[model samples]
Target: MVSLQIVKQSNAGIASLPHGLVVLFIGATSGIGQSALQSFARHAPSPRIYTVARPSTFASHESLLASLRQSNPTATYKLVEADVSLVSEVDKAVNRIIEEETKIDILFMSAGFMALEGRKDTSEGLDPSMSTRYYSRLRAVQLLLPLLNKAPSPRIVSVLAGGLEGPLNEQDLDLRDPNNWSSWNSSVQATTMATLMLEKIARENPRLSIVHWYPGPVDTPGLAKIQKFGMSFPNPMSQEEAGERAVFFTTSDRYAVQEGLLPVPAGLEVAKKSGGGIFLLNPQGESTDNEAVLDEMRRRGVDEVVWNFSQKVFTACNVQARESKDEL
Candidate 1:
């Protein structure tokens, strides 16, 4: 486990790194993503930050951004109004970014929720929980790959279950059947598919650095929403600490394939990437090993299956979107 002191010390160097780093945050309206955004705004040297918020949250999110502007007057903050629960909206959001920015230095995503009640599908005919956690996130990455490759040390940090991968129902990839779908099963499927698909992207784009982190029980508005479900943990990590660690993960060279942003600390060596080139991290920000589950998935070419299925979903979303426009 990387100690909190080390995380903070590493994050402290954000101000020294080159200025005007391009960063985009999805689901930053609240919770871990919001905390990380605040931390970055406080420390980064003139970062060009872009965030997405649904229409319902835009006003409140703007208030939050106003505070961040006060904290760091040099940073440029742009909020794209879009709901990430649909791939079509994600495509629109990334298109706006692509038109404006030449490159993206960091892409931080923590937009998702565990639907305790049941699976709720979006207008695009996708489960909102799955769409937020998997489909939209991957859609954003796919659309932003060109810009990310242009950056010096591009990093993608996804806040979700990383080390915890379990048996995948290869037969039912999306868990479409009611008999196969459950909140726990959906979460596992999302995380497992994410690791596999992300690893594929890493191999294809060797220079890119990807970190899938499982932040065990963070104290945030998101968690508070689910508190009535009778869930409890011994001690939840403070949001501030999680934010600091997130900044370190985004900027530190220890997590990179090539040193470009912050330099590696004196005693630490660059982190070892998983066999597939992605970093599966635990809550403590340490590299986690989950080959037992991943190796089989890869050997069976399940990664490709997941990718192809995801592409089909994206294509369906586009078709539905176009149909809606034509009807209108």
Candidate 2:
């Protein structure tokens, strides 16, 4: 877990991106996304914030927007009503952002939640949770790569587990494992896959600092989503602790100020010093460079295997990364 001091320092500082920076946020309507926006606005000096969410969520989102505007009148908040879980919608949204902006400094994705119901796939043939949590997040990152690359210190913060990776269910990378296919399994699979994939992307595009973080827990409207599926995380303490950890992660200042409210803390700082790789971050806004895990992966030599499988997934999705020309 990231320490309280790191989060406090991050939250307390008045920071701004290198001037002329743009940001794109997915899942901005609730949970970590909204909290990240507020925290980013707390210290950011006039940032252009674009968020994608659904219409029903937009109403509540609007209220949050009002509060943010009230906090920082200079901030520009653009709410894009779109179901980010859909690859097509993500494609359209990325294209829209690219149509206007020359570059995007940060692509922050926090648009995911757990489902209690058995695996549900979207019209895109993606499992519901996986669609929103993993594929959608990756799609946004992939779609916005060029724009992000344009920035001097381009970064992508995807709110999933980065450090807590597991064996690449080579057989069921999609978690179709008939033996166990519940939300618990899905979360683990998604987290592990996301962690490895982020590493792969970092290696492929060293210029882009990719960090996947597990935002301990935040008290958001979306928090109750898991129960709707009629299932639990199976680990009540972890869930409870995650919620508690979320508070510090969002409010902390050390990583927040350094990373600049990109969402979930990042390994940007850590990766910068150690070379490009996924920064497995915890709630208090610190990176976990679990050398053990990295060594193990290196020993197993699954990086290529995981990367190849992910590329197949991304390829099958048929999405192209685009740069944003929009200023806001």
Best by lDDT: 1
Residue lDDT tens for model 1, 1-328: 7888888888888899889999999988988999899988897899999999999999999999999999899999999999999899999999999999999999999999998989888899888888999999999999999999999889999999988889988888889898999989999999999889899999999999999999999998888877878887668998888888888888898899888999987787788788788988888878899999889888989999999999999999989998998999
List model 2 lDDT by residue over 194-281, tens digit each. 7666766777777766666766545555656655555444433233334334434432332232444334445424322212265567
Candidate 2 residues lying further than 4 Å off, grouped into runs, are: 1-6, 15-19, 227-276, 289-328
Model 2 lDDT on a 0 to 1 scale: 0.64
What lDDT score belongs to each candidate, Candidate 1 first?
A: 0.91, 0.64
Q: Positional deviation of 179 in candidate 2, in angstroms?
A: 3.8
**TM-score per candidate:** 0.98, 0.77
Worst 10 residues of 2 by lDDT: 319-328
